[model samples]
Target chain A: MNTLSYGLLSLLSHSPLSGYDLTLRIQPFWPAKHSQIYPLLSQMEKDEQVTFETVAQSDKPDKKVYSITDKGIDSLREWLSEPASAPVLRDELMLKAYCVPLVDPSITRDLFQSRLEYYRNNLQRYEEKIRKIKETSDLDEGEVPAYRDPLFGAYILLNKALMSCRTNIEWCEWVLSAIPQDHT
Target chain B: MNTLSYGLLSLLSHSPLSGYDLTLRIQPFWPAKHSQIYPLLSQMEKDEQVTFETVAQSDKPDKKVYSITDKGIDSLREWLSEPASAPVLRDELMLKAYCVPLVDPSITRDLFQSRLEYYRNNLQRYEEKIRKIKETSDLDEGEVPAYRDPLFGAYILLNKALMSCRTNIEWCEWVLSAIPQDHT
Candidate 1:
């Protein structure tokens, strides 16, 4: 199975979740569309890696809630033992940044300004998330969940996200400061 | 045309390059295979966004060195004016990080250890690159290249890479410290 398939199983290992819930939860880590996820979930069900139950909603149509099976856990363990592939980052901004000399100074300023705002928004979201996790999980100030705790993974991942967001913000601000102001 | 198409043009805007050179140069910002790049280069050529000349090599086979056309510069300028799309990051380590509890403590330790090494290696490479840029560009300590300078893009991009690498290295070390040592 592909990495995304295993990623789905990884989320299910925490707790059973509907496809919609899985889609939302996986966004910060691995971004997958509903179109890609639904087909993979079906294939995973056939492979016995995951099983789903049809839950009927009163106001909405029925949905498939999936959970990881023993086979899935075994697979995840095996996958974890192997070396993870290198990360792939495709950012349109980097491409644009390379050609910034072709555009006006005002345009360059606007580009970095908007990106800085985006990272600021993300930083706030991550901070709020970590605070909520601490409140709900009863983690004390500067305390981390135990390695075996289900919240441990989420905790570290959120910290990573926060760190990355802050770094991006710093970079964008640096770029903006470096840009020459237009006198016209 | 796709974002990758624009990305190829962005690199070519600086100077003429072969498909092989483009593939190598784009790796830090956007990872693409030669197979994916070759066909796109041909398509870009067909669309008149780029032109190429046959460059004969002493020992190696002749290669097509591509240069961005006026059409390509117009495309890149238009693209820079618009807001860039959100970055897409698909990291397998992140997926594995979420399910760390399923594996043994030793396995988790190895996972982060290897990833830490990967980031450290990248950090060194980026440091060396920035040093060379400074040496060749004749910039003083803490002096950044001018916005109109060709080295400007590479300088800022390297700084971003250095920042990101250091952040990842920090995160990996933190994760490693959080892991409990196995005492059998």
Candidate 2:
């Protein structure tokens, strides 16, 4: 099964949304191109996991807004309950690091420095996002915090990303220093 | 160009080896399936990057030991010098974390716990490997450590994996604690 299907299902379970809306929601973290999204939505519709209704527009093309069906929710819940597989890491930096001893030491140092800069920038961005999530998740006056609230999961996900950025930055720094000044 | 081609070139630069030997060398870190390797070797041979000679065996099928050409070495070096791309992360755990709020909190908690155990086990394995690398890299008397020695790169790679495991375990622990004790 397409994993993007599950991501869309989670989004649609919140509310009926057009393909554009789904793309926008996922772009903040897990980006799916419109080309990918539209096709997947079509497949899901054929599979009866989702259904769409065309809504007319005054000055634009009609939009097909999609919502998750009962089947979609059941599928999403089941997958979420199962154990996740080991991540397939396609990390280019790690690959480069593996081969760096064969190249110039100066080049490897530059690569580590470049990666450190990237991760540090990401750290700042995720930290800001976590702050925003905390503010958004706070209950307003007369609002009830339910145990089943899905926003809690969203909160944890952002925190995990934030932690990941921090980890990457620290790892980059350590690798940079550990490389000998006259490394082969 | 096939990414596996570069990995093979890096391996063969150390010494001439058969396909089986190459697979064994990479299995500890950068694993390439035999199905994938044999074909890529054929292609690399056609590209004039690697050459092979058949060796007869009495007790088994004849082996084709392969060696990298100067062209292959140049190609590997060129690619390593270029800037590495941002990693394409396909982390299933992150996906599950994103949807956990839709499932039972107990399930989410269990996911975090399972992930913690995996990282912890990985941490121990990498730690031992790091120790072994240090021992191996230590030169005996009259041995020269070349600046271009690939062992240096291999050492760094192990360190990077060790750091990654540490980062993952720490992230899992933080997420576990941040989750409310009574989450639904």
Winning candidate number (DockQ): 1
lDDT to native, each model: 0.92, 0.76
- Give me the displacement of residue B127 in model 2, in angstroms: 1.3
Candidate 2: list runs displaced more than 4 Å. Answer: A24-32, A53-63, A139-147, A178-184, B21-32, B54-62, B139-147, B178-183
Q: Pairs clashing in candidate 1?
A: none
Q: How do the candidates score on chain B by TM-score?
A: 0.97, 0.81
Model 2 over residues A38-140: C-alpha lDDT tens digits? 9999999999999999999999889999989999989988988888777655556665666676777788888888888888887888778766756787756
| Poorest 10 consecutive residues by lDDT, candidate 1 chain B | B175-184
Q: Name the lDDT of candidate 2.
A: 0.76
Please list the residue runs of candidate 1 whose C-alpha ends up more than 4 Å from where it truly belongs after superposition. none
lDDT measured at residue A180 in model 1 versus the true structure, 0 to 100: 92
lDDT of 1 by residue, A7-118 (tens): 9999999999998989998988899998999989999999999999999999998999999999999999999999998999989999889989888989989889998998
Cα miss at A113, model 1 (Å)? 1.3
Measured by lDDT, the strongest candidate is 1
Q: Write the per-residue lDDT of candidate 2 for residues B28-144, one digit (tens) a residue.
A: 455568988998899999998999999999999999999999898889889888877776565667766666667767887888899899889888988787667667877564233
Candidate 2 docks at the CAPRI level of acceptable
Q: List the residue pairs that clash in candidate 2.
A: A184-B147, B105-B184
